[model samples]
Target: MSVLRMQGIEKQFSGVPALKSVSFEVKAGEVHALLGANGAGKSTLMKILTGAYQADGGTISIDGRQVSIQSPQDAKALGIQCVYQEVDTALIPYLSVAENILLDRLVQSKGAGLIRWQQLYAESEELLRGFGFSIPVRMTVEECSLSEKQLILIARATVQKAKFVIFDEPTAPLSTKECERLFQIIDQLKKAGVGIIYISHRLPEIFEICDRITIMRDGQHVITTETARTNMDEVIGHMLGKSFAEEFPKAHVPIGETLLEVTGAKGGKVRHADLSVREGEIVGVVGLVGAGKTELARLLFGADEAEAGEIRLKGAQLRICSPKDAVDAGIVLVPEERRKEGIFVEESVKNNLSVATIAKWSPLGFIRSGLEAGQAKELVQRLGVKTADISQLVGFLSGGNQQKVAIGKWLDTDASVFMFDEPTKGVDIGAKSDIYRLIGKLVEQRKGVLYFSCEFQEVIGIADRILVMFEGQIVKELDREQATQELIMYYASGGE
Candidate 1:
């Protein structure tokens, strides 16, 4: 059987150590989970393996023979592939699905002859069909949904016939059905002797699909064990370097009069939906992908204009035409696509934390840098945002830290209703704890929070109440004590 192994892997970024003497190996036809919290060197190790970054020191081997992988081409030639979570950045939006799937083939065969478009589309269609998916090969990637984009990446990897494939948070954007499809593809790959390296923050998925698991912590290998030998609590403890008890950190904050109320709100994919968030309450909106949860948040936050609805804040009617109007009306949303829409990644953490409320620090139409810095420092500490200082670019931080900055930016605003759509989508367990605690603190301050997410378990843990959306409408509401995963799925699937 083929084997891929890396021993004594070491890497540093700007003189800061990222990976320290890490070792990992995977055998052909086995699903091996490479797991760690964000910034825990798992990504660093994978980058070195995929040739995105070279290790400062390490030895890599395949089937007991040392191999050199200095670039992505070298890795690809050696039958290695990676399916990253950031699908849009990796895909060509204007290209047809077939072209994107066969991109490497086109690049390799450049100037060979006239491209046979029909044959290419036919091959792509067959490939997708082989995987039991029905994505239109002729459709432009831009027209495909987020989940479809993820599948395209997976398909591209399979077409490459990779010996070792790494799936990084593959289910982050996928629906239940799409996730099952992905699992089938993984199963097929395994049966064909492909080594699968799966990485995700969801413990349930890991326990379900992976055969063996490797845990990393603080740039070092913690343990490698058979999946059947460890439990979720044990795995989480190893990942966090300590025993973790409060996974959700939900606290009791007395619910008060309604702080924000929406009636018949309609926008993009959102139909006439009604909801309310009381002071010191967290009301969760849960749904599968394309179920209009995000659309509802967008309309409430004025990211999209409402065609018809009444949004009242503290019993005062507000006309919100745009995001600015929503912010001015004391409503703010931390969007689902945090990198693209929630925060400016190119800017520093301090700047990101202050941008939304810069006007408050700038009485003379010029921002007081000192005051802004001070405020940022406080928020960073409050939000537990890990950075080399507030001036570090937010793009350099881990997913969880970046998310903290995204939510922190709006803390200074006069927004009473804070809307977070999938705030913990890619965040890890430790960071998720911090975020949940932050939400608790927000509610303690009597700030009504609208937590929109597909992670029903998380919502059930942290939210006092839950609203399930189906298609473009809210179909059911359940208190935390009564909500269950099965019930949420039933409502999300349009049950009466």
Candidate 2:
């Protein structure tokens, strides 16, 4: 028997349909996969299911009984919960882990009274222990790593005794070991008869963990079948409405003389790392989670001070004291955490696009509104950012569009070298293609790029040369023809 079902689900926002005649169902003890590209209404459908949004038209049934869910509280009462991809927003950073885990329970049990601090901590500790997690109950959520926070969200859902749980892109920030642990937890939940709705762009994961698959495209249901019955190509075709020819489009660009050279760069987790990128070259840096990729990128971007290093740009020694110094030296970094470091979420798309080049649009100590808007508009159209208007808030856009805005803002600068740290993280396949095309365009324009990624295939697909880092140092460098997934993994894991 199905534990949950929805039929003819229809939703529209601002006179445009976000979902259309969608139907879905989940059975007890089943891990059902939901697949879709960005802006294809997957999130909308999940929102409706979790009662974050009321469906404009649909019939929702729980245990064969039709019900109306008007709020998140109602969804909780009906035994539903969701773990969103944006973990930072989903969690209360300042709250203790114990409080966060039992927040709803504490509020309900207190209701105008002081929380039972001892009892709450004890219970939360036991709960986390049962899940094989050893996180300190009193530690602030802000102090935890992304993977730990993700596990806490799962524990919260489990504590709620949810019959149906929706996990949206939960593995995007996780390491391989953490992901394996998550898979184990999901197995436990499945064995406990809980229904799981898993959403991810990683096809291999879907096949490994999901029993059934439902593909959605352009806000409509396309296909639903058992995971064993469908292949990756078929699933990609369904989600995109056509067969995808190449996952990565690596363009051929001639490499020129050295553009930026780093010798014995030491800062943060990066120690004694020497690297160089030539003009028109895409240099991929591959490493494990703590292999110093991000730290190295930070040093290059001037986010962290290099204690001892010589940075040469265009054959001249350069000293970068701050991010502005890096930018002024023709080096710009598209950060890994787009929402936190790369964008001003509260600002309009226009403001975000023109932020880096505000001086270019302003002259004589005066701001020119017309020139700013025109420039932002052109870049918006050029980058294919989907927004109703340039004045729209950047936070409201999808992950892919938000990323485009982040990269677009830097394009206005005359930076000769660009460093992209996990540029395609949390984005869908279609958006990834767009980003790859953009990277190709950058290299074709004779600009150098430093591409850092945890995904080996991405490095192999986009990079002209690959550098594998291990334990805060570069262990090996390979040309594109010499780099393979096996070889990269060997060096990334500190193999001899």
Candidate 3:
């Protein structure tokens, strides 16, 4: 029987249609995978159903009763719970794990005279144990890793005994082991008759757990089909709105002399490292979270200094004591957490775009407003960033649009060797293709880009040389032709 169904769902923002006549159904004891590129309107539709956003048109039915949901409480009361894309969507960082888990519904005395901490902690522990989670219930929320927080969120919805659960890219930041644990938990939930709306970019998890799959494009439903009948390429084609043809366009560019080389580096959490990124070559670094990938990038970028090592740019050994030193040496890193470290949310897009190249644009602390605005506008148009005005607050833009601004910031800097960490994270499919095209353009300019992502397909599809890292070590190296998803995952999981 269908636990929940959405028919003719329609929504828009500022006259821009987000979802147009989308329909889907989730059945009890079944995992329904929602597939779409970033900004494809999957999250928007779910937000409407959860009362976070109001639908301009549609009918949502729960077990045959048509209902109107106007807020999260309404959705929760109707037995619909959502674990959003950002795992800590509603979590308080400073609060204890138990407190966060039972935030508003804390067990209290005298109808809210005071929260019963002991009972809450004990119940939280019981809930975690019920879901086979091993973490201490009394620990602070900030103490848990990204995956642990996700597991806790899943546990929260499952413990609520909700009729349907919607998970949005819950495994994007999880380690391989943590992902396996989450899959097991999902299986347990399914056995208990809880319908799952599993949303993820990772295809393997879709194949592993989903009973049926629904593909969405441009906020409209394309098709919903049986998991057993559909192939991966067909699903991908539907998500991208095109068939997969030469996913990675790796051209045989004439690689020049080594541009930057890191020799025997030891600093921060990263150990001895020997790597080189050359002109006109995309060298990809692949590793599980906390396998020293980010740390290595930090050391290379001089965001953190190496305790013992040497960095060479153009055959000259240089000491990178700060980010400016690295930038002066023609090295730049487009960070993984673009929101935290990248664009200024409060500033205008044009200001954020020109901040990186203020010296080059002015040279003497003088304002060249016209030059900056023109450059920002040009970059925005080229990257296909969706925005009404350049002066609009970046905080208000979609994740993918914000990412374009972040990348555009660096493009204005004119750095040759670029290190991008999860360059496509949270970017929509249309924007992702734009980024793919942008990366291709970078290669054509004979510039080097070091791309790192947990997504195997991205690395396999982009890099000229792929280096697989495991436990803070490079385990395997494959050329573009030799690299495949299975081979990369094998090396990533320490397999054959």
> What's the distance in Å from true for residue 95, model 2?
1.9
TM-score of 2: 0.95
Tell me the whole-model lDDT of each prediction, alpha carbons only: 0.91, 0.91, 0.81
lDDT for each residue of candidate 3 in 1-496, tens digit (9 for 90 to 100): 6579999999887787888999999999999998887567787888888898999998999888999999999999988987766655467878888877776576433475777678988999998887667888888888887667877787778777788999987887777787887888888878988899998766777998899999988778999999999988889888887876765556567888788887788886776677888888889898778777888888888898679988888899998999999888888888876766777888988888888888767857788888888988998898887776788788667677888888888885668888888887666555677777777777778888888888788887778888887766667888888998888888878875
Hey, what RMSD does candidate 2 come out at?
1.8
Compute the lDDT for candidate 3: 0.81
* lDDT tens per residue, model 2, 1-496: 5579999999987777889999999999999999988678888898998888889998999888999999999999999999888888778999999988887887787768877789989999998887778899999999988778888888888899889999998888888887887898899989999999999989999999999999998889999999999999999999888889999998898899999999999987888789999999999999987788988999988999889999999999999999999999999999988998999999999999999999987899788999999999999898988787899899877888999999999897999999999999889898899999999999999999999999999999999989999999999999999989999999898898
Candidate 3 versus the native: TM-score?
0.88
Provide the TM-score for each candidate, comma-separated: 0.97, 0.95, 0.88
List clash counts for every candidate, in order.
Answer: 0, 0, 2
The per-residue C-alpha lDDT of model 3 at residue 15 equals 82
lDDT of 3 at 51: 91
